[model samples]
Target chain A: MPPKPQNLKNPIIWFFASLIVLWAAPLFLPTFYVYLITEILIVSLFAVSTNVLLGFTGLLSFGQVAFFGSSAYAVSLLIKGTSLPFAASFFISVGMSALAALIIGLFCMRLRGFYFAILTLAFSQIFFVVVYKWTSLTGGDDGIVGIPKKPFLFFNINGPDAYYHFVLLVVMVSLALLYLIIRSPLGEVLQAIRDNSERTEFLGLQVRNYRLASFVIAGTFGGVAGALFAPFQGIVTPELLHWSHSAEPLMISLLGGMYFFFGPIAGAVIFVFIKEWITGFTEYWMFWYGLLLMLLIMYLPGGIMGFVSEHLKRGKDDSR
Target chain B: MEFSYFIYQLIIGLSYSMLLFLIASGLTIIFGLLNIPNFAHGALYMLGAYFTYFFLHSLPGVSFGIALVLAVVSVGLIGAFLEYVPLRKIYERSHALQLLMTFSFILILDDATKYFAGTDFLSIAIPKLMDGSITLPGDREMPVYSIFIIACGLVVAYLLWLGLYKTRLGKLVQAGTANKEMLSALGINVPRLFTLVFILGSVLAGLGGGLAGPLKAVSVGMGETVIITIFAIVIVGGVGSLKGAFIASILVGELNTFGVVFFPSFAMAFTYILVIVVLLTKPEGLFRTK
Candidate 1:
């Protein structure tokens, strides 16, 4: 008798169970901790979105944070400059990033592997420079501060817990959709391309189009996270566009497990918590981080999720 | 713009182009031969600059030339150690591991540099003989140091030409670049050739750093700044071609210098725009064989 994998048995039931647990987490946590969880949710979404290109499509984009930060800037400016609603600005920013992604992707997807990665970084750096130097418009290094936000109609969702719930809802929906995306035929096609791009091409699929689609999807999702970040944090900065910020998602995805559907989210949670814990003690967190990253790359190729998957596989093998 | 001033800026651009060529060529060779995208090349360059600065500053009467040579040699050795350490172990791994390890090296080297050199910017002293400016045909005075840099670049270029076209080792490296397994089958020690090529590549990068030390302010962020620009050069030049790297560097240097005169705010963006245009038209690079 073999045990059934819970994930495949009843995904809907599992989703609701997980959501209910997450929804009530704030109830047990202290009031000050709401901000922390909200941040985790945003970054986790960012990580998962990055995995779209990296894990599924096999394209390593180092400039993902360009979309994230640009979306943040766009949303922040839209809120301040126009009378648009939050939803409008959010979607608009995401749309802008996707459009930008298309433009950049058209040029970048011309190359494969290492060349593709560097080209993306180069493009992102260009954007970063623009945002940094355009002080008159983007506030340069000072960045735009005091960004205003409007709560949902008559809900008065001003409190931290209410905002947390709002963020949680957005994250849940985004993750659910992304999960569906990963489970669909489209997802299968992407994995096929990642596994053997030549064979996928030989199978009558346009590899470049799929890769470009992935770039746009990942960029749109990353933009959504950034859009959420600006209003959630009440600020937008040029640092968001920096190459280092782009590297964060890569680190998170790698750390959590690139193979697992939920790996990057787990990685992002671990990353934020580690950041919070380490920064509490020392300013040289980067040094420690480098050391940890070295060890992780050297020893833990599967990340935390990889480790879990290996154990699960071992259990299955033992049972059989 | 006045022709005289344009030529003056052009000379500055040329000198900087030479330095850029030195860095990009090394990276080109390493990428061609070893198949490892050595992200730490910039860090190695930065280390050379810091080394030269320290030696020159600490030993006041010591000549800048001696300091430069020592810096290049020492950093070359350090780069060899870097290759022997984590890089050798992960050569068989995925591109992800190679990239992560190199990135970790960047962080580690950056922090280590901060620990040793502190957070302050350091500059090299121009040698007394080359401290003066020389009068040009257009009645503009050009820095002798700039001319020296250009001369050094020409010398290195000529030497590289001789090495590649006239020497046994260069042929070995070139052959290895084409097919490592075939080169090994011909009874050559391919691993040693790889190590030697890596060392040579680092030495070239170090030389660029030494030359650049006196020109630019040495700082913590200099490595990353230079690396990105060099990446542009390497890409535009064609990944594995020295000729391409040389031409692209000059193009980039000129664009950066003169582009500022036209649009001061968008000077840097011009290089990236040029890069995008190149990627669109010639994805393999300007000098790619295929």
Candidate 2:
């Protein structure tokens, strides 16, 4: 991977600056587009959580959706069944997802490559089965709907505009923390494990423990995203827990660059738009989906963001 | 509860295991031989079921056996073309890329199948020869088709063994799988061998699909559904090991049938539980050939 550009005057400045633009985007654009952007934010969070495992930890997990869906269900159920406040339920749901992650990661951290991927997939399916069949608790296909929106601080979050802003606040804070972690020493160690596990192990570091920690953290973030999604959509179905649903972030991660921090965000934005555009023409979107994947893998391995960065780097080299 | 009931479940389980083994053996062996995880195997199986039904409907008077044979063979030919055309390009890529490439085929093939077959439950006709039920040693009546499927499993096992251990092409295949570069250097057409092995695997999957149509409802996404179980089977057995796949298939098949009878709701989860237990105990698999 090419070195990330440090051309900006200040990244924090650029971040908040772009966020301000995004904050104003809803005002000018149609109300429907604001709703779509909220969906994009949720998806980005999901994809970024996945990147914590894939890019940082070097584990290509196909089961992160297990955590994602479970968190969503937990929050939804808590709201419907109990009087737990939004913050309390969301925190509890996040922790719940992390605990599930810890158990799965305990078993999965031992395996490498395909073994890890397959094991995680099996674990995910177990959750899906439980949520689907345990109709009494999960409501199965009916799911838990009509989840009323709770107030965020002093502001009411009943409308789409308020919900969109609330989602932005939560996601932006979570992403900032995520960026900080990726820049930390533990983050460096995770990358080291990904690059060369044996060398890291030789340094007397416990590889499996680190993997478990990364897994838990990622799963917790995934949970937060899911928790937000449940109420945003006003329902939590078994479909959320399905393996295909898990593939969304995976596909987005592949579409955006894995190595780059914002790759998944870009991927998610493009993904939602493409689906909207393509579904307009044909119901059989799988062919086009496959073709796009093929083209990405064949020509632009780094994904759209990856390709753009590669081109930018080439331009720099030519100038130099 | 009764001895006869036990016998019946056992036979049913065995017959079901035979179906899984037919599909999984091909799936597992292909990974060993070609080092390619043919993700579209389930799609091919679905096609087999659909094609056999198509052939039967078109002919109107054709024997079920003949239609099944023709369908399996035709799917095999399609597999050959798939390998020669697109897959041959990506044989040397990373595992992730290889998986994505083959998975793409699932997307295309499944949609095409729906477009052609019109997504409905199609019942497979049980031919006259194997339509009757026979009494077992316990005086329990069993479907002759179940017995026929078991026989098919036995024949496939024997043929697989015979071909692998007793035939020249089999030796070439084994040699090719073991060391493709060395085999190529020895003036052997390694690419052709790879294509042949892929086709063979496709045929076995097709057979499984063709045979399974009579026993189960053929519907859309059957390919995706079965493929996950097949993955669990291979994972439990250990990928690239035919013997492991065989044993795992039997274990899973039994669990699948019995799990349904006992805990109908949790039946599907058994495969994953089995896989987790087996992996926790023995990471490679129960019988790790490697």
Highest-lDDT candidate: 2
lDDT of 1 by residue, B122-228 (tens): 88878899999999878999999999998988888788878876899989877877778899799998777778888888998888988898888998788888887
Please report the candidate that would top TM-score against the real structure: 2
Candidate 2 has what TM-score? Answer: 0.94
Error of 2 at B161 (Å): 1.1
Which 10-residue window of candidate 2 chain B scores lowest in summed lDDT? B92-101
Worst lDDT run of 10 residues, candidate 2 chain A, spans: A1-10
| Structural similarity to truth (TM-score) of each candidate | 0.94, 0.94
TM-score for candidate 1, please give it. 0.94
Tens digit per residue, CA lDDT, model 2, B1-290: 78888889989999999999999988887887788777789999998899888888898678888899999999999999888877887777656556666777887787778777877888887878888999887788999999999999989988998988899998887776667788889898888888898999999999999999988888767888888788878878877777788888898999998999899999989998887777777877777655
Task: Residues A186-305, candidate 1: write the lDDT tens digits.
Answer: 888888888889999999999999889889889988988998899888988888887767778888888898877788989988888888888899666677777787778778777788
Instruction: Tell me the deviation in Å of residue B41 in model 1.
Output: 1.7
Please write out the lDDT profile of model 2 over residues A140-243, one tens digit for every residue.
88888898888755788889988998899889988888887887888888888977899999999999899898999889899999999998999888888877
> At residue A226, what lDDT does model 2 achieve?
95
